[model samples]
Target: TKRYYHERVLDHYNNPRNIGSFDKKAIDVGTATVGAPACGDVMKIQIKVKDNIVVDVCFKTFGCGSAIASSSLATEWVKGKTLDECLEIKNTDIAKHLSLPPVKMHCSMLAEQAIKRAIYDYKVKHEKLNNSETTTIETIASL
Candidate 1:
């Protein structure tokens, strides 16, 4: 049986939006790369967060149409959402949005994982920054 892709999927693949990387060194930026080479799918997602909200996002995917579409859709959905809201974006939702087949379901899963990984990185960096600031303040008070 031949399968057809959803229009949204085809649109995303044909003209993928936010298909590039950002400056990783930026304080507000977070990036994550995830994939299995054996599966022939690699996806990298980057996010810029402000005040606990995702203000921007981008992705680069090296894979099939499904993988590209999934990542593209993920980036679009995550922008303008809070970190917690972004976490709520599930693989199932992505699959449904793209009308992905069971075989391509893993592509959506990869997108979700990428988002989570980026957010985790952002939180870790901010935590370290906060801790450093606190230590500096304590040191100043003791002087």
Candidate 2:
């Protein structure tokens, strides 16, 4: 069945932002890959952290337009946010921002999962790389 999509979602789908991947192995980079098995949607969200802030974020999504738009907007919202601030990002917010319907809300949830996972991954890397230098975020999805 067809469903309605918000204009902002269409805009994002048409002109996705930060649509790329980063080197996952980079000390300052955290990569999280998530997927929705039911829909065959896969999303990877990667982030670069400096001083516990998300300086940059990138994403690659292999899914429907909603998933792509959700991820694209997620990247835009996460950039320039502190790790804690990023943590505050919610799927509901993404849904509201894009005006997504209940059925499509999972796409936003995917984005949220990707963001948190990436942050956690970054924290792990940060702990390890504390003694090392810093650098740069990819496909991320959620169920």
Candidate 3:
């Protein structure tokens, strides 16, 4: 079964940007890992937030081309934006950008979730450091 991938998706997948991890233990970093059980596709998105701005981001995705491209795009979009601005990024935007089919929409959804989760993790961490911050994020199993 042949599936179509947009040129944008191929471009991102073939030359993904910001593909790496951050020190989740750092006070300014937020990390989140999300997965699609049915597809066994997992994506980990990490962000370094300073003054409420996403100063840096990276990702590791274990999935298909679409999933890889989606997370790759997600990282690119979030960086240099405020957390609130990052929230404006909807899965639909990623789907449209990737020209993903309905079946592949889940990939974009995962990316969105990862972004939200990572931001949340950052907030939690910051608050903990201030005696009201801290909420270490969810799974990455081995990260």
Per-model TM-score on C-alpha atoms:
0.85, 0.86, 0.87
Candidate 1 residues 24-52, lDDT tens each? 88889988888855587899999999999
User: In model 2, which regions exceed 4 Å deviation?
Assistant: 1-3, 128-143
Q: What would the per-residue lDDT of candidate 2 be over residues 1-143, giving only the tens digit for each residue? A: 56577789989999999988888899999999899877989999999988888898899999988899999999999999898788789999999999888889888999999988888788776564432222322233213
Candidate 3 lDDT over 15-128, as tens digits, reads 999999988899989999889988999999999988889999999999999999999999999989998899689999999988999999989999988998888778777663
Error of 3 at 3 (Å): 6.7
Q: What is the lDDT of residue 26 in candidate 1?
A: 88
For model 1, the superposed segments whose C-alpha errors exceed 4 Å read: 1-3, 128-143
What lDDT does model 2 reach?
Answer: 0.85
Q: Number of the top candidate by TM-score?
A: 3
| Pairs in clash, predicted candidate 3 | 124-134, 127-132, 127-133, 128-133, 128-134
Deviating ranges (above 4 Å) for candidate 3: 1-3, 128-143
| Model 1 TM-score relative to the real fold | 0.85
Least accurate stretch of 10 residues (summed lDDT) in model 2?
A: 133-142
